[model samples]
Target: MSTLQNFDRRRITGPDKSLPPVYDSSPSAADPLASPEPAERAHRSPSSVRPIFLQTGLIPSASGSTYLEQSSQKLVCAVYGPRQQPKAAGAGYSDRGTLTVSLKFAPFSSSRRRAPNRDAEDRQLSLRVQAALEPAVRAETFPKAGVDVFLHVLESDGLDALVCGAVLAASTALADAGVELLGLVVGCSAAWVGGRTWLDPSEQEARGARGVMGLTCLPALGTVASVWQTGELGLEEVEQMADECRRACDELHHLAVKVLLESAKKRLGRS
Candidate 1:
């Protein structure tokens, strides 16, 4: 059996990497890649090479909320509002809505303990997450109010893939909040494996994997929203990666739509 000590953090994040194992068992830190395990795994066969968990309605205070956990990697998202303007006086509030995203990783959320607040990595994730979400939201409808979306990463089995999950979590939270969306935004990723692209590669896989890309899209419009890639790949390979990413978004959108509708009904009953 490989003990926890056998996996070196540096090696995992090193320039040359390999496949990170994927699991769909517990929602906790057992594998660390799966945070809150996706409830739909039973529908997917054990043999499916690409495994992911899709979940929603996990946050209460936000206009809406959603949680996605794959293996031990986990993200909890909350959509706070079309609420009052922030502290910036005479701040440029557009006819479109303003979105402010915050990303935080709990100290115990990773294999190595992290600090309590936003570190450099957290700040970067917030920026990337915002970029991924902005295109799909129709901000003009909310006027001066800003929608505050929070992403709390409880665990990160594969650091790179977890960021992709954060993008998905934020988009779902936005739809759940009912913030006037142009279309649902969905995110997915592909990692370089051997001579081919690994769709949704795990952390370990990421270490050995050469290049990775995180893609976000507007499913209804059939348009690309954001494309983020790290490392290297050929132009033709990149196009193929985008195509695969769009497919992932389409599948994820179905679950997002179902969750948002169910959440809206619950909110109506409570109100």
Candidate 2:
């Protein structure tokens, strides 16, 4: 008998052998360039956001942590640091402590497989997250220390919404860790599509939209901390979309506060 170990059983032997190409059949798999304007323009009201679910003190090892979820997106944030800063070359002590943020998407968080290492998109989002939160945090109070916020995206439905959710979760974790702040930061996103503004656009909606706007605000302080926009739009259109995003952020802030209060009450009861 021929050597069985050398047999290539996995190879196709028949002349008629063929393989079908795979394709993504999910609802969000529509072509990004396909215009959604025609269908979305007729919709009167903006897209309603799914109910938010939040909890604090979920990670015992971290100084502070919070878990937040809405629709198909889920995120967990852990706040650490406000600890001693390592001396660096040409680095001098400043009046205000530094705030560092690391935003990561889990390997399995997306429809397609993603590598674990941080990518360019992750780096950019991290910078935006830091900027959005810096204005709200009382960094000067810590002097030479540094506060590190780590965000782990368990699932992601849309990029704009993902970043916005990270900001909210990080701020909540900071508060839970007892970090002083001028006010909590809330984040929201709006998409301008087919001459209509959609609040909290789904991944499918965002891909087909003309432009998207992200806004972060300190609701209690009545301040806009950061605004990010993608695609093209006139100044007037931008301002209008921003207003819509701000309103949504304010609503989210209220819900965040309620969750924190409930968590505090539960902790007190346990004690």
Candidate 3:
């Protein structure tokens, strides 16, 4: 999968030579081609996440690829391999294949440009995504092969949303790659603020929240797979956040499945 192996990650910083940037969210941005920011987030409801757009198979050279957007945040995921397991120092034989996942942010993804290299937060988010999706993949099916998932955050609106979106995008990319899967994983997040849980908070909105949470699940199986929480929350509030996030995840799963089904039908017709 040369496309996946050679995806244009390095040029992710500037506007595409042909297309105008429609996802920039930096407050200080002055690019005339950059789309205006969405309406003030304060007007959004507490029970809803931002509306989203998802599409797959965009990278013809990759086994599978997908791009997803929710207002200001844009993420792309590419999957490669089911090929040779790289023989590294002291590598041992394995009955199950391995999955190597990395998440990186484009330098201009945030208001304050991020470093191009992976940082501590990026590593942490990568592990969280890996842990959430591993349970759904039947890795033994590939034996000595491996699958590599690469996630590029082209833009970001919030830390919680970034992680949640990464999990959602990666799982969809794996399924699109035709990997053996026990089930698909979906993610949702919320912030506890003003004595209530905000379904999905933007970075600007979450600044003063008392707590934040991110949850991932296998909606088809009705089971939660991972949970990440921060700040101090009472037991009652924690329970509420989990419940809200789970419901949101289920809703997201329905939307994701619908899109995947439609894409599959089109592919079948083309074949």
Candidate 4:
């Protein structure tokens, strides 16, 4: 963690649809976070899903690599690290490893074409993704050398769920590369919509959300790394949403572990 957290919280307010408001002024009456009470979780009829799928060696130049797709989201991650340390006096580490993350939205990934330059939205998301995985990574061990994690969002169905998908993808890729982690980092997003909570919201459902929450968990440790909530909600309502997010994360972890195993089998030519 950096000293940036100690700085005065900066506020930004604009009429932008993509940017979150500096201060929530949409009135608690209509605010999703400010809902009167938590709604029951939505359930869908069980269907057959492969459990997990893995893409190996996508980044030829990287030390370790993998790509994964869960439901509607698709992500590709490459891990490069435990390598050279920057020739600086006070860099990251030398013995262990540092994780540096770069997240980008591919041009054809979105319904609209992505711009080449990193936008404010991209910067915000990259920062969040990095923060979500920090607790699971052991940075001090690397000393001056840092591990590089790259994420390419191959698609965004219009849901504000990029953080969740990216977090899981990044962690899965690291695990696939055999990076030592405190535990698996699993992430999922839930949206409060139509007086009910929806798990793994589609692009449309996300945009209609009252409050969108993204949660990351360390399943083996039985701990939560991060819980991000935007929009408005009452205390009890927020707690309920948190519970839903936890359940969703559990599902994602199952998929992630399956992917890790598949990745290993591919490397070993098991099947």
Candidate 5:
């Protein structure tokens, strides 16, 4: 046997992982990136959410595409499919189509550099996105086929907001692709900070949060698609968070509708 026969080509020579540094504001007396004081955060009310700048059909090559921005976090999603699903690997066949979501971050997306490949956080976020939008998609309409959504985080502020942004962008892209859907699914998040719930908390505000909750729903149908949360919360707190998130989802759903309508009008104008 050749001397190189046992070598695994896939392994990188050096460490292939990078992680974010623990962020602490207490030590920073003059660090410009220090977290703002409570008074400084007063600009945005507890009930208010960050302004969303969303656009659909942004990628001509994709069957559907969306670009989303909420403050410093930026995400783009491209949807392709109803294409053939791989059946050669004994993956078996399913009458219902599959919705596969992949969320990855740019190497420089966060303050700390990220790995080139999808990390655990990225995979988890992708799963959250897939779960949120799968219920809304009429997968049974296209049997033996699959729809794939790829989300890229060009930049990220808070982990909680990033997940919601990815879900929101993916859902819009699916709608833009003209996939049959029960209704548009919108995503929103809230963080329990300083003994209060704050909608759309930034990275700084969320770092010290007592809890974080992410919600996605079909607001028009008054149905929730997915709810993700972390940290200890009482039953009452959970309910309160859910109610707040749904209200925010309703607001976001209206925005999704407006974007889709405008995109359709533009397409018509072009044709």
Candidate 6:
């Protein structure tokens, strides 16, 4: 009898209220948003790179993993497999192992919220990563196997820089996983603004720039692995940007080597 009918109760909702307008209370001199002086801009170096922090073995469950940070950009990469290949009918056998790269941006990675599904940008970045890394990895070493690299961007300040960082991080993770590699892959990005090339550009600078380029290299081999560009630029400008990007990659290569050495030392000590 009680299940036959239910008593209805009216629910009261709170009235909508508009937020109060915010105002700056600080003096003009102390305002952070104020533009910098001409002298200050002249003194500031545009070619400087953001400090990089790289570490490995953070994910014990993964075959290999790395964490990389530069300014507000942060990402983690995990490498798995070189194990048995999947048995899917379409998964044709390869004498050399295949490299499958997947890149995802966390919902909070950017200023705006991102969806969990992979977008066109994400797919393109994944392809770029694979291209940059494939040359460096000795995939043929493991026959009929596959290596899976998963990159998760925790934060993103610049899309170009984020892709570059992911390239470096993924290669490092593969190496940490004990995968055979021809050479470590190092990635660098540059922004062409006002007829000048700025290396390792921040998000704001990248947005304001005329063009952006990302380069990945195999340091030991002294060869460029991949080059990606956006926006229009002349041949001369492209050459200049490429040269700058190569130099930056070389610098990053040194730092990456040091990090890997330190990580190996720690592992040896533990063993």
Error of 6 at 61 (Å): 0.6
Which stretches of model 4 miss by more than 4 angstroms? 1-52, 88-96
Compose the digit string of candidate 5's lDDT tens values, residues 1-271. Answer: 7847987886555565877567667656533245433433556888788888999877899999999998889988999987886675767777888889999999779987787774678887788888888899999999889999999899999888888888778888998998889999888888776567788877877766678888889988999998888887777887888899899888898898999999998989952
Where model 3 places Cα greater than 4 Å from the true spot, the runs are 1-41
On the 0 to 100 scale, the lDDT of residue 225 in model 3 is: 87
Model 3: per-residue Cα lDDT over 104-201, one tens digit each:
98887887768766466888878989999888889999998999999999999998888888888888889999998888899888888778888888
Q: Report the lDDT tens digits of candidate 6 across residue range 49-140.
A: 78899999989999999999987999999999788865878776678888999999997788676767845678888998999999988988
Candidate 6 lDDT: 0.84
Locate the minimum summed-lDDT window of 10 residues in model 6. 35-44
Q: Score candidate 1 by TM-score against the native.
A: 0.76
lDDT of 1: 0.73
* Error in Å for residue 236 of model 1: 1.6
Backbone clashes, each candidate: 24, 0, 0, 18, 0, 0
Clash count, candidate 4: 18
The Cα local distance difference test for each model comes to: 0.73, 0.85, 0.85, 0.70, 0.84, 0.84
Q: What is the lDDT of residue 28 in candidate 1?
A: 52
lDDT of 4 at 195: 64
Which residue pairs collide, candidate 2? none
Question: How much lDDT does candidate 5 score?
Answer: 0.84
Give me candidate 5's TM-score against the actual structure. 0.85
Better of 1 and 5 by lDDT: 5
Give the residue spans of candidate 5 off by over 4 A.
1-42
lDDT score of residue 244 within candidate 5 = 90
Model 2 over residues 39-60: C-alpha lDDT tens digits? Answer: 5433335755657888899899
Candidate 3's displacement at residue 104, Å, is 0.9
